[model samples]
Target: MRTSHPLWPAPFPILIPEPRGYDMVAKALTIAGSDSGGGAGIQADLKAFSAMGVYGASVVTAVTAQNTKAVTAIHPIPDDIVAAQIKTVLDDIQIDVVKIGMLGTPSLIAAVADALAGYAGPVVLDPVMVAKSGDTLLADSAIDALKSILFARATLLTPNLPEALKLVGEGSTQAQAKALLDLGVGAVLMKGGHADGEICTDLFVSRTGTQDFSALRVNTRNTHGTGCSYSSAIAAGLARGMALSDAVGHAHTWLHQAILHADELHVGQGHGPVHHFHALWK
Candidate 1:
């Protein structure tokens, strides 16, 4: 028997808290190619996004039937379909950041630019021109289209040493970075992974000033998707509302860790992928 008090009834009833609404999750979109090998491109981008605790969406511009050894064949998605995919995602979801990679053709690049014309979210453009296996991913004709149509719209342009050289046409690293920054992109991250040096230095150039990030070169053949992982990690940081410089710094650290532990994973023959899940699983 329960005693009744001034603040209580004879029969006590248990009270439960009402369920709360779900919190809004940060979302990121990857406009890139599909790598069947699960190393680079959309797969790597999505993995990096997830590792950074962001929801990932993808719009595939092309599909490559390849492994760690080489890219055997590539089928570029139609421009209309690529545009439709981007539009559908944008129509329903509020994207926090967009990461672009591996537009195989000029039409596809133009289509991607047009689709993302009015998007206000931060965009990180990874001008992917060649595969790790030395396979041509983007045609020579598409380079001009990429610069003209998309450069102005990008919040950040991430190009490797080779791609930077191609964009600026034969110059020192600083000169190439300056030329790339002049293309109207808000910022440029010139990657030096391809350069032969004891320390790999990445240059982040903007209108304000330039920042240099250097790390010891991790000597390993398993560095296939370093570029993709770096750009997507930056996009992930941006989606989490980090400042541009902070985001780049975090991404640089993440990429270095991934590369440092790359040899742990055994995936395929030839140039394997960096361990994108190193932080999460380790």
Candidate 2:
């Protein structure tokens, strides 16, 4: 014989619910320069990460004075400050993925590499050499430093045709990608947007195998920040626990849609930026 409470049934066993835990948000860090026009670099990376539903953090290595048409000038931040920024963020927040872009100087590159030496998460390195307007964002002398300091540690290196060629010399996309992979990078996404073809073909080469992604090229003048956005999107996917191939596939689709809808916004007189918010508004 047992006494029952008001909420309990007689002769029934008590049922207790398990305690609930807080949901953790996916977070990504972008170590890059700042684009004043808000189309590329840290701005584009943060936007892309947010668009993919990932929390975004950034350490601005340099700041550019430019519009969509051209990069007028770039002022690189001090190496110590850059390193401090990286340290501050990593010490407080749990970074799930990292997207590196536009380290304008060798010192900045080394600083970033050293700061991230012990980070075990995936890193997406976009070898951003030139701006959309043909302005050189990276110094010619810093190429060797980048290769030595960061390439081998990168989980994925995303390079446009020109950047890939600069890394591996003249060769087919597959050859260039293979050459880059030989440098100890876990993978390489060789973008073919700068090549001559109606369809843009991007090759993803990793230790496992090679996968090709192609899309019908959309003829448009508003193609700024494409590289930065693509790499950031891939980082976001990786932060969400997606596989490398799946992340690249999702980034390819996102970039294609952004390019297709780029003309929707009018910001500058020269080449405008892609619609980073296309999925949300359009």
Candidate 3:
């Protein structure tokens, strides 16, 4: 009763094969603020996406007049304009993934949520609260709305230590990030860049389980847009169909390298930005 066909390949393998080709170009859209500094927000997003070899698009929710030092001002775009930007992009392009960051107010949050609802692509949210220079970008009242509308619809949430604490309530930690996964979002990435230690660790949690990713904590003061870069990288990976954990892992790795590479190249007088193009010259 043994029947083995010569033309048939192996029946099955637990290991998955890597996808190949220009069938590989994935599209990622970022709905966030404009960082005048060119280190965070939509600026960092598009750079990260391009560095990762994926097409990047953006819809500006707000305009942040800032630099590596501080966010001088945040001007939220009109709700209609924000919605129109999203509509224009989505109508013509097939977005494979979405990365959301710093919506200045509750109204912008609602507008972004409504605009994104129809697109069932993977969504990554970076709950940007305070800027690296200690300036607050998002309004305090917008916190609840971000959680209710944007977080609920997200496929992944990238929250730094402080943002995680706020989202899951103050005094929250790695344990609280696990609790975040139970809140209905598909996954949560709790970044440990703000932690006081020799190693920088990022925690990725989901219904399946929790995974910790860490690297040698570089002692560089130029970490302006780390959160934005990380989330956009994750979105790019997701657009390429990488599993959630795999995407998080790749993002962490890429960000770690970026930090190390930016260890010397001075840009701004204050906190500088990671050299996103390091891979090019290396």
**Ordered list by TM-score, greatest first:** 2, 1, 3
Global CA lDDT computed for model 3:
0.82
Tens digit per residue, CA lDDT, model 1, 122-214:
999999999999999989999999999899989999999999888889988778877888888999998988888788888888878788887
lDDT of 1 at 139: 91
| TM-score of every candidate relative to the true structure | 0.91, 0.91, 0.90
Instruction: Evaluate all candidate structures by whole-model CA lDDT and list the values in order.
Output: 0.86, 0.86, 0.82
Output the number of the lDDT-best candidate: 2
Candidate 2 TM-score to native: 0.91
lDDT of 2 by residue, 1-282 (tens): 112112111221112122222376789999999999999999999999988878999999899997998998889899999999999999999999999999888888989998998789999999999999999989889998999889989999999999987887998887888889888899998888998878788888888788878887889999999999999999988988888887887788888888888999987988899998887883
Candidate 1 worst ten-residue window by lDDT: 4-13
lDDT of 2: 0.86
> How many clashing pairs does model 3 include?
0
- What is the Cα root-mean-square deviation between model 1 and the actual structure? 13.5
Better lDDT candidate (1, 3): 1
Of candidate 3, the 10-residue stretch with the lowest lDDT total is 4-13
